[model samples]
Target chain A: MSIDVLLQQIVNGLVVGSVYALVALGYTMVYGILQLINFAHGEIVMIGALAALFVTNALIAVGVPPALALVIAILAAMIICAIVGVSVERIAYRPLRTAPRLAPLITAIGVSIFLQQIAILVFGRNYFTFPEIIPKTPMQFGAVIVTPNEIVIFVTSLLLMAGLLFLVNKTKIGTAMRATAEDQKVAGLMGIDINKIIAFTFAIGSGLGAVAGVMVASNYGQAHYFMGFMLGLKAFTAAVMGGIGNLWGAMVGGLILGLVENVGLMFVRGDYKDIFAFVVLVLVLIFRPQGLIGEKVAERA
Target chain B: MSALLENKRNQIIAFVALGIFLLILPFLAGMIGQAWVRILNITLLYVMLALGLNVVVGVAGLLDLGYVAFYAVGAYTWALLASNHFDLSYPFWVLLPLGAFLAALAGLMLGAPVLKLRGDYLAIVTLGFGEIIRILMNNLDKVSLPGSDTVYNLTNGPRGVTGIDGLNFFGFKVRQGIEVFGHQVTGLQLYYFVFLAIAILSVWMVYNLQHSRLGRAWQALREDEIAAKAMGINVRNVKLAAFAFGALTGGLAGGLFAAMQGFVSPESFGLLESVMILAMVVLGGMGHIPGVILGAVLLAAMPEVIRYVADENVQQKVFGLVVIAPEVLRNLIFSLAMILIMLYRPRGLWPSPDRKADTGGSAK
Candidate 1:
């Protein structure tokens, strides 16, 4: 491989990784709070991506500027998916909160399929051309050539992640979130509204996931209803890899997952791209079940 | 009759009624349409698959999200060994056990490494394993020699292996068209009987196992793994048995599926199928054979029923959107059903018979 070739792969990996990190944050946040694996998080991304695709196309058709259209598209998707995320919690998950472990998880799968079907209904089954809002020119940096969209994906994901970090660390709501995640009853006793905190967590996490969906669609240049499955699985793997409940760990895990998957592309075929994240997940769960950055806890009996 | 239903006689009567209903089903299906027969065939397949999976998910209480991996293994085993792809025309009788054996082996292999992991961790690993198998299947068609241009073909990739042998017994081949009892029995109707037999066998086996020592051990494990282990239940062996036996049962479904479809593709075994089957177990009461059968039939048949009613040819419209595409609503209905069921009846539509007592025990 040439110098530029390796750099290009790294750039592609980082771009994809940033989106994976964003999606991972959703999975990690929900998992942290409820010890629930939000299986539909990927579908939220799909819905967001599809919504963005439709809105951007519609806006451009109505003669809106590409940049402004993109902004409106992202915002609409975030709002819709945030509602979707919260609705999923209130309708499917909350009722089964005290139920057996399997109930909510299976319900999550149901919600996933439900969301995908809604996407299919709104947008047809096949891939749609995502409107090219970003300029189509590639920027040359030494031997590496990066596209404008890649920079957008990387910068947007980082800024959002940094914002989230600040929200969780500096804000009172973040402290409440941390407290509830630690112990809901104790947090409730401390005058934190557990329901409100959990709902807020879902909204914020889902909004981030929607943004990732838009980024990934722009990066790939196409949006499909079915695109959520593989990405969702990969993001879930990334969440596990970063330590399930740890926020920053999800970001680190996403970047590493992207790099590893892309770096292995030379040896493996493209179809094997989705397999890399899963393989890492199985290995991490087996050897270091707590994850790379996750603080170890006593095994649940 | 009440007395009969009150004891073993009740089981016999229920079985007889079920037997009669099932026996007349194909004819009724034939009267309705060939498509109906196909639906029954698919439903029976789901029933067997759900039962096989019940051993792992329901009894053992290990939430295996990737149960379809065993189903794929079983299907492929029959596809490769019995199909013309390898020029090996083995009979279905010989291939069935072989297919199931391969799946059981896979289950054991999977069980060995991840059985120690618990809760969501175990669930994620198994899910990953399922995806890995699928990706490998999709990508493992050609292997280029390191420095040479030579390529080795394993599976045919996406196009899939076709022209596989159909179900046969000794020399009596059950092909697409055959006559039996003056009615022209389509191959589908014949397969329905075959599936019914398999479903019964799986039910019988599961029912017996559910009451056996091993079954109690599984029940114990599911209730409290640490307590079971402390009580000398041999958690590892029990867990492995649940995984292996579950795979073996699922393999039967897969083997017959290959024979029925006459083609095997990775697409047939996807994450959706696994989740659908899992939904059947969850929706029907877990660990309850009869309830699972109910779930299997409903889920498998409902989509086809909706497709019929919501046909674009009709004037049906939802929200004035023409309802032209039923695919959109099919998943929506199932998922909606799942969410509603979980919300309203988290113990499932039909709670296990003994679990009725379990609720009070846990409470007290």
Candidate 2:
């Protein structure tokens, strides 16, 4: 409604957009390499957030300092999720590599549902409050206000993206990943272990998703067993918007989606805010299926 | 005379026996428990839905993940016209055809958008469309009119529309039982017969459609879209037809569901329902009518069977301990079944005999 309100919404969007970007990376990387949607990636994020909550609560109760407990929880979550991401690929996806296109997709959906059920069994059906370890002190910047958590979420996401870019562009493993994405058979012919590279890609993407999960939980101040379902859909929408399989596109798509959704909610009821990303997704598919940064390639015959 | 003739005669006898058994099932199950009859009714509805989806996914290889949206359309159509919500009531014949037509239009709308997209992209877009429909249903309760201060309650919001009128034909209401040969029949039993007749009609129609020229076109498209286009098949029209026909069945089923329950809500047409219907078509043997029906019946009955066997009383008596919740177990099994079946039985449990040598109907 006002300048300050618009600025505040923009700030809110940036923080959440960073998280969406992180999750989008997971979807993008998987899509890039395997040509799979990785429908279960959102469940990995949920698992990360809940695992962090569990660890943090336990550590804090045992007289550990809140700051240290948060760090430990974040690391533990990343590792747990990396293992989960890799294992899901091995068990559910590997056998169906040569199967029909719809086979793996259906299996992915199954994996998603299975993970959610497992989460429900472990965490029960209630929402867990994320511990307020980080200080939420608001800082004034002219007409706009921002919180310390918002800055942390944004900075952490940027650094992770930079690190990932460096890995893909500079490191040998990153080169192998890119080659694999370019052509799996050629990469294998070049003596690159395709399976291992694919597993590594999943690990890296899921680890970053873990950080995003924590950021989301810390930002929202609560975590639920099935919170990732809608979040996953929205993040995947971001991946598509940015031109699925493109890392930079994922980052750009996530931020744009978040900004549009947050700013658009100002005029409409908040209850319908979730519809914005999907509406964007449909419009994008109809108008520009390849996405903003995606190169226009001929459709495979 | 010939071995083939003898086999045909035995098959005829077997089919007659099975048909008689299904006809008497409602009364027999009613004597045992009313709940079983309700489960069977719902299963039949699912069979119709699965068959409808089979036209799109199994036959045409479209892989629609939001097939439930059309079901919602059909259900809401019945709810609005047959319920007291708008102070209107339509006859069964009028509502069913109207609902089916509306759903077919929706299918066309959905089909048009994703005509260029393929595989997972189409799947995701359809899924988003389905979610959009559900969200609209959930939030369309108090919509404000443009350039005016009038607020209208269309769907009645999350609470949903209740008190829907049952199917009425020639002054005979399904909600009220009819007498036959001096025997008192229950309302549910009568509804069961109606649903059975409709489901049979659907199966018969779908079976005929599968062997028709249009059916062959759909199959060719499913196997290779590019090739199908090259072979003089109207790809766009065939795809749209598959969606429309599939949606027609889903809509008819949804309208019937509303009549049976006398209630309709956004919750009934969620993504899980769509996935479950897809699972039924895939698990049964995509493109095979008998297999699809079998998959639908098994899956629809699975949860009910779980609830029965895992009832706390049954669990305590049988196992002497309740280690896990029955609902959670049901969902776990449901999810696992999807993954495992896809992994091992990629062509489904009862794949088409002709498709045995081919890949899963996809040309790379």
Candidate 3:
């Protein structure tokens, strides 16, 4: 009801929105290149979180400093998830490239369930809380209180987004990615290794998902086996909302979805926050199926 | 004998066999205890739900992740009308069709706008629509209904609707209560009612639709939308019809479910339920009626059966030592089954002959 409370909610929304943006990038980028909805992308985020947790736990067991252990965990998660992203493309999706669109989609769903089950099998189903490596202290600026974790989440996500944009527009690998996304056959004919480019795209996307997972775990202070399912759906909605094949659109869309959902919770209940995001998605599809920035890929439909 | 005569004979034999199986199933369940009978009833209800979903995803080639929304509509409709809510007492016959009609209306409303969106976009949009309905149901009390001073206490929010009256016909009750060999039974009667409804409707609709003009149009659309459109098929209308028809069946099933359980809750129709139903359709050959039913029954029964097997703590502990715990093992087995099916029989267990060439578009 108060201005301060509203502002605080907005801040919280933005932080959560940043993570959504990061995960949305994975979806948008993969969809851009392959026109496949990587349903397993959220699971990649989950794997990343677990990877970080395990790595941090291991580092701490070896007497490493808490902050250093956290850093090690992030890097390890990113690298591991990158490998997972690439392998998923190689093994599960490549054979279905020429197959019907539904084949890959089903396969993706299978991979998602497989990964989640594996996670459950490996790690106990109980919600796993990370050691508080980051300080929980809030900075009070005349009634606008922001936690250190929120600042880290927002900054890290923005930096990743900016880095991705730069890589896509300013580098050779990025050019290859864009070319492949435009037309895979033509890109292959033009001396670009389409397979390698796709693998690279997955690696980048999965790495981003990994970073998002870590950020979310750190911010929420807990991670669970099925944590990524709803988040994955919401992030995918964000991707579609921003225009499926466009990267920056995914970022903007994620932030908008997060802001709208958190703000709408003021009028409704917190449990219905997901519904707000979904409603926005439906409205966007009905009115502007091309999404917020419009379709970048001509044959996106 | 003529080919036509032989074909008709084969069909007759198949129908007779199916009828005999259904007739004997309750007797077998009676032998196994009423709980198993109830499980079979729920499984049949799921079969109906999966069959309805098949109309959308398997037939019309629209991936509807929110198909459960229509089910929710049907259940709530029955809940509101049959319960003491609004002091209204509708007869079973009246409420059943009314529920189906309202669910069909919801289908049309949702289908109209997003009919143009294809594939994953359509899927996610539908998913959102499902969520919106759920939220509305949850928040109905907050918003007052038009022309009513009493806030639309229709849903009863999270507490859900309970103590709903069962089906009754002129001086007779279909679910008068369950009955054993010589004793009166309450739950078994509801189970038999639901099971019979599911068996009759699933077989009738699936068979009729597969041989109808509408069925061909659905298959054509599934094969190639552009080609189907070029051939003078109104893609929009056909798609909408698929959605509406599917929602109608879902409504009937939902009503049956509500009547059987005597309760309805928003939680019963969540995204997970949607995914499970979709999985059933996919696991069974999409568009293959029998396959979908099999998929539904297997998926519905697997968890319960696993729980039954792992009921003892010592057995669970021993199983945990040998393999995974029952819960994790159950999910692993299901997921593995899906993966194996995708790899070995990507077309599903009994894929439609027309759909054999179109292997890539399984979900659609």
Each candidate's DockQ = 0.51, 0.54, 0.51
Q: lDDT by residue for model 3 over B1-364, one digit each (tens)? A: 3465469778798779888988778768878787888888888889889989988888777889888999999899888888876566688788889989999999999999998788778888988888888877776755565678775465888788887766666555666664568876555645686567666767798779967999899888887787788999999999999999999989988888887888888899887788889888877778878788888888899878877764556464765554556676666666666666666666666666555455224331
lDDT of 1 by residue, B1-364 (tens): 5566779867887989978998998989899998888888889989999998888888888878889998988888888888777788888878899989989999999899887677677778888888777766776688787899988656677777788888988777776668868868888888888888888888999999989999999999987787889999999999999999999988888899989889989898888788889889888888888888888888898888877766665534535556446667666776788888878878777778667422102210
Please identify model 2 stretches exceeding 4 Å from their true place.
B1-6, B181-183, B356-364
Which parts of model 3 have CA positions greater than 4 angstroms off? A1-9, A296-301, B1-15, B84-88, B141-152, B176-190, B226-230, B306-323, B356-364
lDDT of each: 0.85, 0.88, 0.83
Q: What tens-digit string does per-residue lDDT give for candidate 2 at A50-113?
A: 9999999999999999999999999999999999999999999989887756667778989998
Ranking of predictions according to lDDT: 2, 1, 3
* Native contacts retained, all candidates in order: 0.62, 0.53, 0.48
Best by DockQ: 2
lDDT of 2 at A112: 93
* Candidate with maximal lDDT: 2
lDDT of 2 by residue, B209-261 (tens): 98999999999888778788999999999988998999999999999999999
- Model 1 reproduces a share of the real contacts of 0.62
| Candidate 1 wrong stretches, greater than 4 Å | A2-4, A60-64, A299-301, B1-12, B144-149, B176-181, B316-321, B356-364
